[model samples]
Target chain A: MVSEFRIRTETESNMAKQSGSNKSRLYVPEPPFRPGDTPDYSHISVPAAHSPVRPDPLCDADETRDHATSLIRVMRFNGETQGDWVPGISPEIKRTALRDIALTRAMDERMFTMQRQGKMSFYMKSTGEEAVSVGHSLALQDTDMIFPTYRQQGILINRGASMKEMMCQCLSNSGDPLDGKSIPVLYSFKKHGFFSISGNLGTQLIQGVGWAMASAYKNSDEIASVFTGEGATAEGDFHYALNFASTYRAPCIINVVNNQWAISSFQGIAAGEGETFAARGTGYGLATLRVDGNDVLAVYAATEWAAERARRGGGATLIEHFTYRKSGHSTSDDPSKYRPESEPDVWPFGDPLERLKTHLILIGEWDEERHVELLESCKKQVRETYKSAEAMGNLSGETRVNDFTMFEQVYEHALPHLDEQKRMFAQERD
Target chain B: MPQMNMIEAIRDALDVKMSQDSDVLVFGEDVGYFGGVFRATAGLQETHGLHRCFDTPISEGGIVGIAIGMAANGLRPVAEIQFADYIYPAYDQIASEAARLRYRSNGDFTAPITIRTPVGGGIYGGTTHSQSPEALFTHIAGLKTIIPSNPYDAKGMLIDAIEDNDPVLFLEPKRLYNGPFYGDPHAPAKTWRGHELGEVPSGHYTVPIGEARKISKGGDVTILAYGTMVWVAQKVAEDMGLEADILDLRSLLPLDIEAIEKSVKKTGRCVILHEATRTSGFGAELAAQVQERCFYALEAPIQRVTGWDTPYPHAQEWAYFPGPKRVGNALRSVMEG
Candidate 1:
């Protein structure tokens, strides 16, 4: 039926061309499925596991051109691991990965509920794209810097950032380290090697490249990793980052989380129609890979490969994490209004957390009973952390950030004008 | 001491800092092998090697963004935007990222980057090449805006800016690159050979940001100007035979309100001048600051001499420029009231 419709549309288009029509019209891309329609991702191609062979970490960028088009999946849907891309990490690490992914989802759920309850102003969930951050974080050294978008909270989670502090930031309470200066979830953890999150999309890509350049200039062993959504690839900073990374051979890894949706607009709006996002890096003469983001082993192996290449001064790599956003863009969005209500259930890439758990169980590293117990413990931990963070303050509570902090941190030292303005502001309060 | 033009002085400053601090980097479009379009970064790449002084792609957003990252990573990067008019493309990086990095990160990270760009008119480069965007940067917090009108201040302030812990927008007046302009386009070109302010001291010296220089002292009226307009104001006061107290505001954001108040209170009148457009220009801020600090001392309403609120036109550049004639009229008007 789909082929017949395609043939009929092509025939009509060809007839219109033959009728001497020279009118030019603007073309806007529309998604494959809309509200009330059945979301059928079966039309989309999903290659089998271990289909594309992994290249050597030090291979020339041109050698990875084929890899950019094919998927580097390690775990099959049946929970059987079979591929060179499989990262044979220890069983303990596999269990830890599963726990971290589960905890990230649990925390996301709790914070989202808090926002809906008016306890916080906003929240963004990583949802089905957990492995993109957790796997990458675990693969890279703890000292390596990470410039992330708002959605990569899993990086901080895997880095052992205090859940109370993260919750306090989200609640914008007195304990919020940012002092209510930043939007909720826009975290900055210097101690954890996580760069401050900038709400402006794609600005951090170039910064990561710059950081890598600085590392190389100083002859340091550390490399930088940066992440942005597929939607933000259209931003000029992304291209600039790739240009500099390839030109100077900066030691860095650039990850584009292609979750198939960018809020109300789909990935096609970002020029994801005919070409893959990973292919964008191939044009810049950088090694590029497309991995199954839901498969934790694949994400870990790809990130490890990229990190090894970067640390060895072999240049940068761009990895596209093919997955699906299984939730609304943010607390303020309603995905059902634009997309099918069953879209998340029908997504081709299954839940990242569930897949990792299944793979662990298949390898005799985890079981159904332990998975349930881990899920409960994660929820309990989130609840207890929220309680402690709530005691400090919340958006709806009487406790608030100190008003005086508003006049601080404008510069390293307070200038005369800022001093005068602070005095005036104090006087007004008095 | 050496007699240097603004461009040479700026280059000398970069060279001095690069020699002093190994972490100091100089880069921008055409700044490496070509020595920059205006020659402001001439001969630095050869002296410092390609690693320290290199060329980047023509991406202002990328240039500033990467500079911010480098700054956070313990490098004092001095990135140049070839022209001030081309800075809008990177405004987001400058205003949103650089300006807010220190504040948003709660002092955990800071972008101590110095963005040096050529500004102001009289070069006849038209809308794309000529602009005075000091006001645009002055409006942003966590940013220190500086515009030097002479060779000595240019070198000293650029050095200070590179060392400062905050992001500094060093706007070098292209019109005063070789010699100071006194608002006369048709006058024979001048050089900095014998000018008193052109004798820049070699090596290290700090002029301090947020401080104003009293170019010429008087008690009749206070004239506030910056960049090339400093010379225009001095020329207007001399040509009109008025003993005006002209203050060259080297810094705009952390304005030397003390100097402004003292001058305005002593003179009882004030006139603000700039080359940027009239509406919401830095002149407006000067006027407001003057009145707020010296409101009771103010004898007449503050007067402003500025370019018209229009896109800088190629032809009729003189009319668009707030020249000596317009400044003279403003000075006379303020004195009369």
Candidate 2:
């Protein structure tokens, strides 16, 4: 039975004393906590309810206390075995997910080869940040919006964007859906709410806030999730996006994939200790989580919780998926110069795919032959997609058709400048 | 016709348009229940309900971000910034997200949104409320910036802005609101003034974007101005005894250069007046374009009367904005030269 009662703080007068379990105050950590080991991720699981909203920046003590106490729940990935089997992630599905990741990895690998081969201009690999993006995107409602950085093809593949479509985009081919936007692969499914990725850092988070806020204003259950790197957290856009999401209770999930490195800068030296990326969300009175990005289950759970909270209007959630980039920052940067290899070896708990395979085997759900077949099939599919995409033709060469019309779709009636540029391009020599 | 001032004209434009479309919303601090600090949105929330009308946090960044998102997702949101000076914090969202979403998305997404805020100085609002930052927005692509000198176009142009499939920054001239909502920003309405703009077309109609209206047609000289400066130019035109044809530029971006060129070519003389600092004012570009395109039409150099190079002053604001007397002096000097 629920009882109506009030609780007064120890600072209040004794005569105004109140009782009950309300004294079990929780601790909410401030933002930018260190990623490595020490953080009390305990949080008061407030049963999702539409309680009276106390006006913020002037909220009551209870709200402040709630905000202060809600931090990441560090579910240690000590090769654990008790989590749910994420219904529907059958061996076939896992094979598909693996195939998708391999396709993304293959694309990243080949794009670099193409750049070096002087076929394409540039490339950025989604090498190690796959599980968080793929796992989280698959958990979202179909109608939800997706804002991502340049390395989230795993997200697009999982969202059902065909590999041929993505290859067309990366190649800037005439058949590219966004018409040679020269953007990364994931933005191919824009109608599916996957916003185009930006090379400029920390912008998609703000875009996510915009999408989520619009959802709230329109009374829709849809949520918007944005992907960023740990390096981007230092930007003003990150804080600006967070403050907006928390203050308005917008349904946006921020996934800061901490790859432990940002191009040449070690992600370690980017920000000091005790200030994890998840801590950044807590400063704005929102729920947050720091998960083992290598553990698919952990990334899945954190994103699942965040998705539900956003759809249920529990406001926003920030998730930091602790992982490693595993490759050079891009085809252009040399990691060996700054990497110092000591850090990678020191932090290795091994790859996410390997860990998941082990977890599956220990539970008697996976076997060696099945895993081998799965790997071979994934490789086969990646090879096939690349071959077909390669057959589709030139992305950098002169336009073969009126395909430059891709730029024409931006305005309804031709805007004068772009119109002139579009026309000028239309008449240019082959 | 009900007599209304500039603030009511702005609020009425929002109210009537909102009533017609569920997608149109009005949001800003104190705008929901309190009707806004300027009371421009008075009685709107009660009329439209909370979804289409509401107050946001004291975050200009949040306000613009949310609006861009809504616009991208198919909502025509008209967000208000309390003061022009406060828009700096939100400049990122406006410039980066709202302005570029359409272009960056390669036409897959567009921020068909409107940002409304009061600008210009004449009232003693010091540094904060008195700013003319149109040039800042014009420099950013994928954005359509506009300002209205009267309520007739204020309603019509605002409607067009809400309907356009791109982001628009609609700046309201606060000092102009002290009088009629859509009357000449520089003169009281005479029966025959702008008969072409008669009765605001009664029902829903859009004032074409990037077009300028010849508010007062005279052959001697063409005085180009917009927002509050338009009104000042008219008053100065009346005082200088010059046959001035003042063009009220409705849309500043995609800027109705045709109208400016057409007028200048016909008159062979021009004086541009604005309230922004002399450096890179919107008028500077207009003058440059006029000089380039209508180079041979000039009998006199294009004279610009504007706010000094310094930031908006805290005192003698009337002196700061080239009022009728100052504008008159500029017109006289240009004609004499």
Against the true structure, what is each candidate's TM-score? 0.97, 0.84
* lDDT per residue as tens, model 2, A245-331: 877778888888888777876554455434567667766777766665765655665677678777877888777777788878877
Each model's Cα RMSD: 2.3, 9.0
Per-prediction DockQ, in order?
0.85, 0.48
Binned by DockQ into CAPRI classes (incorrect, acceptable, medium, high), candidate 1 is high
lDDT of 1 by residue, B247-307 (tens): 9999998899999999999999999999999999999998988887899998899999999
Chain A TM-score by candidate, in order: 0.95, 0.76
User: What overall lDDT goes with each candidate model?
Assistant: 0.90, 0.71
Q: Top model by TM-score, which number?
A: 1
Q: How does model 1 score by TM-score?
A: 0.97
Q: Is the docking of candidate 2 incorrect, acceptable, medium or high quality?
A: acceptable
How well is each residue in A1-430 modelled by candidate 1, as lDDT tens digits?
A: 1121111223345445653366554445677778988877776556664358888999999999988888888888878888787786999988888889999999999999989999999999999998899999999999899999988998999999999999999988899999988889999999999999999999999999999999999999999999999999999999989999998899999999999888888887897366788999989999998888998889999999999999998999999998889999999999999999998998877888888888888888889999899999999999999999999999887548998897888899998888888899989989
